[model samples]
Target: MSSQFELLTTRRFLPFFLTQALGAFNDNIFKNSLMLLMAFTAASNLPMSTDILMNLAAGLFILPFFLFSASAGELADNMEKSRIIRWVKLAEILLMSFAAIAFYYELYMVLLGLLFLMGTQSAFFGPVKYAILPSLVNEEELIGANALVEMGTFVAILLGTIGAGLLMGLEQTLFAVSCVLVGTSIAGYLSARKVPAVPMENEAKPYKWQPVRQTKQAMRICFEQRPIYLSILAISWFWFLGAGYLTQFPNFAKNSLGGDSSVVTVLLCAFTIGVAVGSMLCERLSGHKIELGIVPIGSIGLTVFGIDLYFATPANVGDQILAAGAFFEQAYAWRVLIDLSLIGIFGGFFIVPLYALLQQRAKPQERARVISANNIFNALFMVGSAFSGIVLLGVMELSIPEYFLVLAVFNAVVAVYVYSQMPEFVLRFVIWMLGHSMYRVTHEDLNNIPDEGAALIVCNHVSYVDAMLLAGACRRPIRFVMDEGIFKNPALGWLFKLAKTIPICAKAKNEETFENAFKQIKAELDDGNVVCIFPEGKLTRSGDINPFKKGVERILEETPVPVVPMAIQGLWGSFFSHHGSGIFKSGKRFWSKVKIVASEPVAATSANAEMLQDKVQQLRGEYQ
Candidate 1:
């Protein structure tokens, strides 16, 4: 649990974290300060209303992501990342110094231009921000690293927003805001200088300035991997939902909650703090692994609380608007705050792993470009969220609560479509639930299995859920060879199929099915996959090791891959095991302590059925 925090004490991660967090903080401070200025003092003198000016400002900030992300990606990939961070932070310092002048003179137009420059700086930083994590940390630490970054980002956003309000409240608003923005920029640049350089693996290519052509090339690189592309889309959708909620908060607070600006701040705090909490929780919840299982859990919480928020809203406002303290005194207000907070918390769960996965899975050479494409999509989705809010709350005449309900329903639709396209998410969720709920699973020596390349795992058969338990324990995805009867079990068929488990039968029963199963096993191994087989072929009714079958020997003869022997203990009497009258006939035990142990891998030539069985039996020992 403390592993994620330990990263902050090290030179590799801490400086980078501070650099990024400060960057986010500065962006929000400047943006929010400008918005506050327009809404309060500059509104009367502006050619357009405050609302239009605010929207225009938002567009100007995000426009750089659309126009310059491709070029940014190219630069990040071609140059050293730490140098890029330093340069970007230096640009921020220069821009913020200009911003100080703009603030001092109340030069609103210059401030707007500075905002665009700030966005441009961020656009360049985006790719390097995420792409550098893998180079800085180990594979196991990637999730924890991402969790901290996500948490820091939301916290910075919250503080920056609040800081803007505080600065604007001062008598010397211009001096205070200018000093704070410029000071933060300088601090950010100093931190960026401490970030260690991460050199590109391949030779640097020539930089191209064509945004349209480079963007298309980046998108092509993004789409080259289905999982990475889907991850990008999912991340983009989260931004859409986030943008929708954030854009409507002030109006919703004013019209529905009957509250002043302070109440809007409260809502913002609840949501932002929730995200920070949730993000930090990801490392612990995932056991420091990039666990995709919790993603669905996050999505479920998001939709559930999103709909609850709509229900929690008051039907009408009182004659007098309430202050923050008065709003908290109301029962429904608490419900609304809790709903927003939980939505933010779940949002943390939803997003951290996807980013980690994108970093872990993308081709190292193209990683920055893939992240750049993700940035473009995020900007587009956020802009779409603004328009969707206009149409739903304005043209369609839907109340804010009604609009929230719409967003919740749409989230469900998007989640279903995304999961359907990539059943891997749902599959991981199922495995994750089993470990967290049904069993308190512990693993020993799982590192005996190779991190990559082909391998075979042989374990004792103990329960109907052994395959799942094994899948949950191992880091890499495994292709399990299961008895056809269990594979076709009506209750767990979909899970088995989703896992791509190969179904086999005794040759005497079905020669073709048996032969095909071997073919599939060989194919999976040939493709560098981990394949696990319960060599005993059936569950143990007597809580003892069953005799190993010859099928394992046959598969090994063909594939000749490394064979890792494993053992499962303490599951014999569980509901899914055959320790009772039959399967599913015994009293169910919740949170049963289960242990899986793996032995060193044996060469294919030395891995016979009897020898592997002896190794598994030795590992199991007296645990059963």
Candidate 2:
């Protein structure tokens, strides 16, 4: 009865959450444990080159997420999510058993096979893990829930990585790792079994014979939604940037800062903490929406901080050992931590929104398939990033910091390109910059209206700028019923169209215009949308709410749902409106203060335009 976030405290979320955390923990535990040991522990006896084998292991693990993820998505969709998760966790048990045997027998290929199988288990689990959230939580709590999950995942990495290091460094490493995986897998399986059944996303999608074919078909379906597809691309780019950043850390510690093991720890901890901190703050910062402002902000930070790290690198060369205390004794150590933490914060800001956005916005029928497509792209990008490392570091004569600078540029370039193609992200970016950089704007009585379902919002027709102001204030999208004259205005028409504005005209000017407008309005309202109509029918020239029109009654006549009364105060005298008309009009276009206010909703069927006018007047009592 309360809301979705309330249930997050229940056993359902915690158990599943622990299962996920433990799985991720065990994964990084085994993978990094093996990699570190292969590189340093058995350097003299290993058959393959240290770097080559380590890189190969990394590639093999990521490969299945690409090749098998689509099939995994289908399996998740067709089978029960909780049931699928159980099998995935159970598979981890067997896989880890094989891993311990491989390590004990000194069979690197067998060890590598276990890693690939672990990847497969994760691949199958990935779609169900994310896709199940929406079914479990209410829409309103999704942002906060996602934030918690994201924060949990990052924190798990922090602990998992350190745990793996400690285990691998032990004398009985294989036994220790095997024990952890077995225990964690059993716990994961138990928690997974407790999760409520979440069925397939699209029961209609054919259960084909071959996974490759299923994967391709799912990929095609995912690409159909432009915004969803954009999210996938953005996610892929994040992987590219993240992989590049994470890959360079050890090298950065060894070469740029002239430090060894402890330095690597400091760098890793700073980055992990940064992302963890940033991710937790996203729910508050984004107003519990899958805000893309953070994405652009994070990208900018990724570029700036990344370039800064290059210049700030200590003018020393080669590796030197330093204990934990000795490393932080240097002033330069804090700089690296600060740089890495900010990078992580921005990374949290960037990645979390895209993931939550993809989950929330994806078509219910094909959500898993869409997520599978996401996994496919992420795998491809990560592999590409590894190859890119070889090319940049191996072929090119660039230093580690230089490689980082190149990645920063790539982050900025790709971000700008993608955001430009999909202006919503840019729109959110602009609004975010405006509200954050400028003064604070508060909303009163915003919850007076329903979160979903049809609602008719009535507001003062302040100026051409009213829609933009309201759009920024609210999380939900609104279809503004603007005058046809304003709609055709060359300057603002495109903006309105981009916003999917509905243009209405007087019956005298063109009967067809009103006809089409009402049809669209009726359809949007029927679809349970928020439609804002200025009953004054035109911008106020008298510095007050103009006479009401019958459009309000007409809309209610068609689809009577909820009539939400709203207003924009302190903007009537601003630049966008004709404050005093003629020569008194201020031409100032930027840096203007504006405010939008909303009042409680009225009953739609009993509401009249005159009553709605009074509601607007009451809300907009004050001015700039």
Candidate 3:
């Protein structure tokens, strides 16, 4: 719904997108064509089995990520990124020329070698492509920009993969594939030439040449922050998961689904389309912010859908290979497609936030290097995944479906382990689920919340889940100050505790509780954390703004943090609000449209409970 496509018209982003997409397209075309040729045409002449050859091809392509990502990261950090991209694209053109020659001669070894060279080019280009985005786009546009890149990349991959397979089936296979690959490479180079220059970050820093030492240095940069390190690990695991699934698609279609090459194309198109759809949806779902909440949702969907795929797949299709149309005619085949598509959808959710977070949070000087570290780990994981699949399917003699089940189970374990390490991801997921399920929350001017340093958030409490909704809308973590009654509720208390929400009581009822609340607020603000308080003190019984309590003034007086006023609209009649007689006895407006309007920050000197309430009222308008 957002204007993500508009970025394509901009000089800063358009050329880069075209360059990246063209590269992906060429890579997939070459890889898929070679794999298809080996699997069918050259299987008899090749020394190795088709499966082994495919695995070897996959490993060879990824080898550069492990070997050169460190050096590439350094170069990206020290060199002008756009210029580096142009040079990389030129390398791509040369490599594709070699690939064209290999295809013409049908030189198997030469083709494999060219695959490695292509991988090398991509490895060098990866850091520059990702790291340059922060320079080209502002923070708010990062998610949308990444979304477009992701969509374009996968779509290009889809076209390349499908086109290669189709072209290889033609009479003049070598000539057709070569022409397309060479053209794509040249187009990529031209696009790279048009990319607007992005200023270098560490132009004077000496570039590292030693792969081993530089790789270690990149790892150190990644380990500099725990979240960043975890993100890299998570991203690597995604590649592991993706590699396992993608590598098995051809075999799965042939042996498992009892379908021919066309079915494999269906599987590829379905999954790729699903990923593109999911990536495009991220900008809307995240409210144009780098929301990590989608990570958990994606992980869960991936596990669930992955496990379901095993069940959806039958033990065997008939001995005869079914065409694409016939494959879809089978009732169970549709289910398999759905499972794979959902897996891709969830995969989109899992990776996008991590990428955005890495870009936004990593130190600018070392960001590209950190990305290289991520690439190295990703390659390692993917290669390891191939071996693991071989062991499970070959040595252990597990069926392909059984291997899928195993991967799904492993995914669940890994997701739980990661979330256990960082509960913030899960916390945000819970907040996101609450907001999305209960209301359609449209955020306006939510970026008014400061990115860093302490800030006091004053909002009118409209419902029981207002804090969760607010947390979901604003990118920052908020420690909500809730009334003692709600804080002590058994059902909701654990959530508040997990979020570290501050609980306060009426001064006359419990002076100690009230006093401790202010102390905690001061400590949090002093530590440069956001603290949110409902200055209205209690939910409005009349569906109108309640009078402001003096506690907000007292806390602001003590902390002197910038006060941001936010208003929640369209929740008054909901089940969570104090409509009719009590909560849940009133209207149950499931997925009711709501809005969160955040006004500009009021200076601590000018801020008061009454004035903040007035600002919230103005923002809320007649929605309540």
Candidate 4:
């Protein structure tokens, strides 16, 4: 297990990562510089008030996501992404040049127009930014790749923002900002040139010029897959919450914390650093897989810390404004910073897996379009966040901290709804907890399980948690076949049901369940799904291999799918096993080392109960 940072050393990921990071950095630098100028110095020259101008600026920048995202997605899907990136980066260089002129001449309108164009460029880059990763890295590396990209993105945003503020304080502000903008753009273009060209996955579709129609089409494509659709919505919700918090930070610092501008920067730094740290930690936490289990953990943290932040805010407002150091000395200031940081950390945990899952599961040909739809939704959610802030803080007259409390509650509601709609998230979380907490689990030759297609996995039944441990070990989803009694256990039954486990009973006990279990197994196999069966038909009462049942043969005779022999080692005496005092009655074993070994698939024509038993026994080998 090499670190995700190693990818930065390779040409395949390094160039594109640089290009993406520099692009984000440059965008924020220009955007923030323009904002600071308007707020501090240029407000008097503008017709609208500073507040209106700032709001308008924010809207203008995000508006392009709504207007051009569909077209951008289509173009990304239709052409080689590297070529598009180069051209987009070149356009950025041109746009930034004009922006430099706008800054030099104090052409505020021109600057705003350039801002919109910058947004348009980013909108175009959004789809390819993510869609290109699958082409650059292997599936196993996708989670790491997403983590790096996310870490780079937030870090760039933070540096660029801080840089803009610093540049604004300089005597030659406009000249310095202009130079950095154009220089960063040129560097981004050069990086884009080095990115390895990726060919289109499918032939170009006929171009549609209507943004409205294309937007609907892209959204329809996104909604076509249930899991992907929910993932997009979940991601959009994150952006919504993020927008709300970011929008209020200036006021939150000034009014609530009695802090000056420097304090706002400190808060931003805490949150941004948290997200970067969390993003980097995701690869390790997920064991280099797109583990959805951590998503629930993220949501929980977001809600918990968000609410804590509300409590952390001091009720008293002093007329004296504090600088960063003074603010830190105040009561509860550290608490507020920690809350914001943890919120960002959990946000990273929430976001990375969904992005990887979307990339992994979406149709490759339409992946760009699906991502485009996600951008559109993200934009809408962000816009909605602004409105929600206006309503809550203005019309509803809620304090900033109170408003945060509302957002946290709403987050909980949204999380519950999402998990209800997609129980797989909760199920995976349970399995992930089992793997990370109760056992230090490892896998051997698990890649022998095919990436795609129907296959039958035969493993010796060691305990009630066998299926879950196996689920956490494998990358793909598996439908496990279990005896009805264990599958219907009051304690674990709901989890098994959520996993869509096929419950079976002997024909003598219940003919319908026995017959129906085979039917469901065949149906799952025919649908090109992986199915796992415990051939022993029951947990071994002793720490030894039970004789394989004939049910496996019946399954192979009907389905004829490839059979994968698997073995679970070191679980015999654990709490879930029948060994010792019986299941759940034995002494607890925390962090017990466990290994799951998988062997090459046995052909359907050659597989049988006895052969699979032998192969599994060989794989298990005395580990138990």
The candidate maximizing lDDT is 4
Q: Give candidate 3's whole-model lDDT.
A: 0.88
Each candidate structure's TM-score, on Cα atoms with residue i matched to residue i, is 0.98, 0.89, 0.91, 0.98
lDDT of each: 0.92, 0.80, 0.88, 0.93
Tens digit per residue, CA lDDT, model 2, 349-439: 8888888898888877667778888999998898899889989999987888888889888888899888878888876776676555542
Query: Candidate 4, which segments miss by more than 4 Å at Cα?
Result: 582-591
lDDT of 1 by residue, 272-351 (tens): 99999999999999987899999999999999999999999999889789999999998799999999999999999999
**Worst 10-residue lDDT window, candidate 4:** 582-591
Quote the positional error of residue 312 for candidate 4 in Å: 1.0
Deviation from native of the Cα of residue 364 in model 4, angstroms:
0.3
In model 2, state the lDDT of residue 530.
Answer: 90
Return the lDDT, model 3, position 81: 88
* Model 1 CA lDDT for position 255: 94
